[model samples]
Target: MATPILAQPDVDSGLRPVPVTNRNGVLEILRMRRDPFSFADEKRLRFGEVSGMNALGIRMVTCSGPEAANEILMNKDRAFANAPAWSYFIGPFFNRGVMLLDFDEHRHHRHILQQAFTPKVLKGYMDEMQPMIAERMTRFPTGKVLMLSEFKQLTLDVALEVFLGLELPKPEADRLNKAFIETVRAGVAFVRKPVPGGRWWKGVRSRKILEDFFYEHIPAKRAEQTPDLFSVLCHAESDDGDRFTDEDVVNHMIFVLMAAHDTSTITMSQMAYHMAKHPEWQQRAREESLALGEHLTYDDLASMEAIDLIMKESLRMCPPVPAQPRMAIKDTQVQGFFIPKGTMVVVPQMANHRRRDIFSHPDMFDPERFSADRAEDKAHRMAWMPFGGGVHKCIGLYFGQMEIKTIMHHLLRGYEWSVPADYVMPMDYSALPVPKDKLPVTMRRR
Candidate 1:
């Protein structure tokens, strides 16, 4: 037989290849799981914008900085896919979810989903969330407590009531929470199989639980015109008169629930942590909230500029979804590096947000960087993409921001919280980036 020609590596073409010291990429994966931002920064410094890694037995490229990020996320050439790559991490659990769909299908589903997130729909969601947020804030424990744990429960409750329109009994709610947690945990499992009692196994099992829950409710949701997201999704129609099938509603519900609650929990945790760390900013936000009165209208929520700044800084520091993953559906070159077809690509959101060439003090927590005077995020169109970019950008962006801001507004009005001066909450990257210790803080009435 004739010799098979091997593709030339980027290093051979004068582009820096990602320095993979480990043969199997296991060590790098572990380091990345431990501290993704640090790992990305180290690689960027050593390898520049485009670098290659042998991860999960695949040649994966990490794209950092605005230019490379825009190239991959924009995907103008239709050379990349979201589903196949994300499937490697989360596809089994979140199958056929909007984020996992690609090309025309992704656009179609997104258009349908957009009906559930229009301005009128979001205003209703905010209305539902405000009272729930206030009621939940009243129940928070005083003194030293794990705010991350509390925020997780709070956001999940908001998601349950506002998104599902279900006042499920405590036992059922707890069971559902466990299922969601397991499903999320499975996405990052190295095992990636349904071995009994394994992370992936649990995830697979949990996915069934979630599917059953949504599937059971689909008939009712389709029959009624409730204001909850689940109901809206069931009845929502695209401008072209397209609607989701039963399976589509369930799949999308599971994915949206996971995305909405888990990510909001992370954002709230970061805001709470940073507010506790910097009392001045907290006070500024609190004063802004006070000006809006105890009951918030949609207009009131919009007027909290200080809270917006702090939230922006919090998102920049710790984006809920740290990295956006993609797969090169066709061979493509990005930033002078050749990416072979079927190669995995990552738009490192966390690393990109902290690029010093883009931000003045990349490591420091400074909300003022977003001020009109500074406007550092304007340095590049993609410089501060916590919600991601391109055609597959988060569909629930406005809903999420409203949720975060509303929750923070209530927290500020009702309580004062603090952490020890030197405390640093280590983040767990098993699924989403969350406080490993659950982010404890001392809380009391304001």
Candidate 2:
């Protein structure tokens, strides 16, 4: 026999029994993890609206509509908390990094971190990055085939140079790159444990190796201030005269590396794939890039409005961080339902970005939607959240954009690329959705 559907309860009672069936037992939770997106879709269809489910002994709610998502993510004080659930996945590796902090503590750390991303800082960063980009892109086989996996390596090298101030030797960089890949794979491992022979164990080991390497170099960097992000961060101080400890610096460095490198790599690959599929857009972007002449300056970055629109559209279609999860610190009410304390709330950017009401013809890869005439994303303040929203929104968003554009500009001018005609998109829901096969492509000089 089917479990009888319950009636919606009164809001005034403070314990409103909504029509949602509680199907969130241990088994169901495990099943959901097997395929998170399909699981979310199933829940949405059955419930007639998204609601909470108890999965893995945690009260979890998967929200879909714009209003519900905005309320939970934006209303930080009353509806949700960032630290509780995020810590479970990222805490072990990152350890009190800004992404895991909330409330006043979040604000304090963000203020200091913001210094590394200022206009003057970005100009310095670009100056440091241009030659690196030129050097790395030159290594690509001019008229030969390539895969995103290979390109991802190139981007990772750029990130190391820009973010960490460490220009890894090719051999050493390759070794660390392999370890980093394994480490990222471990983040989404279903059995989240560091037992022998586990991905988590490998990831934990890789993290230690990275930390030790960065720690050893910090003293030299501090002695002679360099024009790298690590140097800037090492000496940065809070408004209250507080300074980051050695551990703080290492943890934050690891966090920034993982966050910036992986997200940019995925996003850039997606951008390239889209650009290839739509040749006209690629030509337009190339023209936009060439308009600024041979050298790309800070002002030139701001001027490439067409590239910005295309990048925005790519992110909208395929966000690197598809879902943002939060846990309730205390019992709270959302849209008339009493959410119990400790419940895990998910605001899926994938779902929000594809919302039919907010975006017309949502599935189509149309950059024009972001153009001045269309401006579809402006429908809601929280509608287009590729970088997320609210207090915990990604701090490196602008920098990431600048980096992607800079890379795209150089590549569009230097090379022409194509992928297999039947290449299908694959989603890896673990850490973030990356193409399973590393997205194969062929390239030639333009």
Candidate 3:
């Protein structure tokens, strides 16, 4: 038998770059800030499949569709790195967060972090989460309400209680929430500096406050064994006896807390948008929640299939992290496109989610597509990567899901809500995707 020769990549040539007339990404940023979906769709059409653009002083090769996203996210060849690329946007603010680590360091950190999210620990979190969600649901005012703002506060409170073991006073919690908001907003700032009253300035100050807060609490957490995540981080060790330093604990805590609450808030708001828009799904989910009980057990969460499918649909429509950024550590090929070393690459999940080839009626709000009968998500492994994929996939995904479902479960049982028939949610993607107007709904007791 004769051995076949492998074709060599044309490293001398570069990607088919997208023509960008906007210097410094001013026009691109305006388009993305205006309507990210439209901007992505336009890119897909203009660039065909693989293309490059220079934005914010970064030269990025944007890979569209599931195949390219799978190639970049799965990291099969090890040619891409996450940290260096993410640092361009968020490194200064969320420096050394696990998502900003790559290769062995990422694996090491993730191993130590996994101890905090074990099955038993997650159950305890759910146990605490149930009552908090129920209590929060009970307080939602009847009639018109902004569900996004309400959900944001509710999720932040849950995160503080379950993750940090803190029952902050209303004023303190609000202050911390604002701090997180500023820190997150900093990732999208064009100036990337601490000019007075600017996003970067606010974020720098917020990072200091969060650092002080976590550092102050580290000593207390280390002195005792508590079920909270902060306590777990203070004590968690890898199988090899690797553990976090004081700075490591503080850095990880700040990142995890922001990830937990902010992403969960966005997901819940999307869930509310879908539930309120489609009353049939709402009724089905409400029945499931009511039948189970007022408080959800860990097992109950698994069996809530209707809510699960709705959650999947919501994520498919509006993934919290819409785009994944990575840098080419070495020369590579993505779908026959030559990617040179040091080029920033974006795998746009929001664009991939709308690919007509993968999803039937891609823009429609059809939860049944995720049902076992349809199993549309099975079309491609990368088709619905809201939580991302491979080694760097989100560790807290299950907890986030539990938190969102727990809140939705309580909301469904306690209230019936609806948006106007003609309503369309105006999504703002300044940082994470959120309803711009906070998702107004006509909420009332059941």
Candidate 4:
């Protein structure tokens, strides 16, 4: 037997009830974690567009397909809130970050935060990080290496120096990186309590580490002007002269660091795997990078169209933060399916990116599809939303893109690598998509 997700609906609204599975969604949580795309597709086929399930003791409406995604993300009616839903998973760890705010408050904070990401600010960041990136790239070993871990370390290095304006010793950097990893992994941990040595406990303890670091440094950042993110956030203000308090700066700093580092790592790892598998594309992108000279300038970042295409295609295939979560704040309807207030909603961008009706050869790794001649992603407005959509779309998109392009630019100029043609890198869908076997590559200097 199935229960209506809406339980009951207003007759005049003329909306149908969302179909929810009778089985416990909490039980399906593990199965879905194993492969969320397959699970999403299965439910969509069986129950139609708006499928409902209870996961981790919360009832959620999965807004699969383009229409549902459009309605939810566009949020025309302002019926959704990001805080309650995200907080359910990452609340304590990332509390009150920009993504966690709503409506007026969200808009205000975004306005102030926008100051840190302007064209001039981004140029400063690009200039600052290029040398940091180049210095790290110069140290790559000349044999088989775990590309994912390597990228993770590089991105962490970039974030700590470029974001915090601090160059800590190896141990401190490693400690900060470990704290970030624990806090992120804790969000999805099955055990929520602070049991001894448990994920939640580790995350709670790590949160203190992060808070202490940022809180300790906020005073110095506020006292001076620097090009790093910490200084920018400390000084950035809206037209109304409103700026972030020390607490606000610390919260935003922690959240932004995770977002920037994790997403860049995932994107780089996916691109590396793709490049290793398809050396022809690698060769092509390499040529483009070589043409631009050894060190990339702010303007040269856009010239590497080959790298840009590959990045877009890689992001499409293995989107970081694949599913965007929100909760209905008021009675809302998505594509004629009624959603009761308080029901959690998920926009499955990774699954949506592969829709047959939208993307041709959705599973194929063809970068040309994004080229001007093809423009397959243009089929629908929400067709290629790896960064999400509407007002809550990622704020750091420009900075993140520049960082990836800069790193890839350096990588192509200095080295080349490959993986066996027969190999298929397995992905762990449990958390953010990471290669189960840290992708191994045979590398040598160009």
Task: Please give, for residues 347-366, the per-residue lDDT of candidate 1 as tens digits.
Answer: 98888888888888888999
Task: After superposing candidate 1 on the true structure, give the runs of residues whose Cα lies further than 4 Å from its correct spot.
Answer: 1-6, 9-23
TM-score for each of the candidates: 0.95, 0.92, 0.95, 0.98
RMSD of each: 3.1, 2.7, 4.7, 1.2
TM-score (C-alpha) between model 2 and the true structure: 0.92
Best by TM-score, which number? 4
lDDT of each: 0.86, 0.77, 0.86, 0.89
22 Cα displacement, candidate 4 (Å): 1.8
Could you tell me how far off, in angstroms, the CA of residue 32 lies in candidate 1 after the best superposition? 1.4
Instruction: Kindly provide the TM-score of model 3 when superposed on the true structure, using C-alpha atoms.
Output: 0.95
Q: Write the per-residue lDDT of candidate 2 for residues 234-302, one digit (tens) a residue.
A: 888887878777877777787787788888988887888888788789989888887776678777887
Candidate 1: TM-score?
0.95
Better of 1 and 2 by lDDT: 1
Give, for candidate 1, the lowest lDDT window spanning 10 residues: 1-10
Worst 10 residues of 2 by lDDT: 1-10
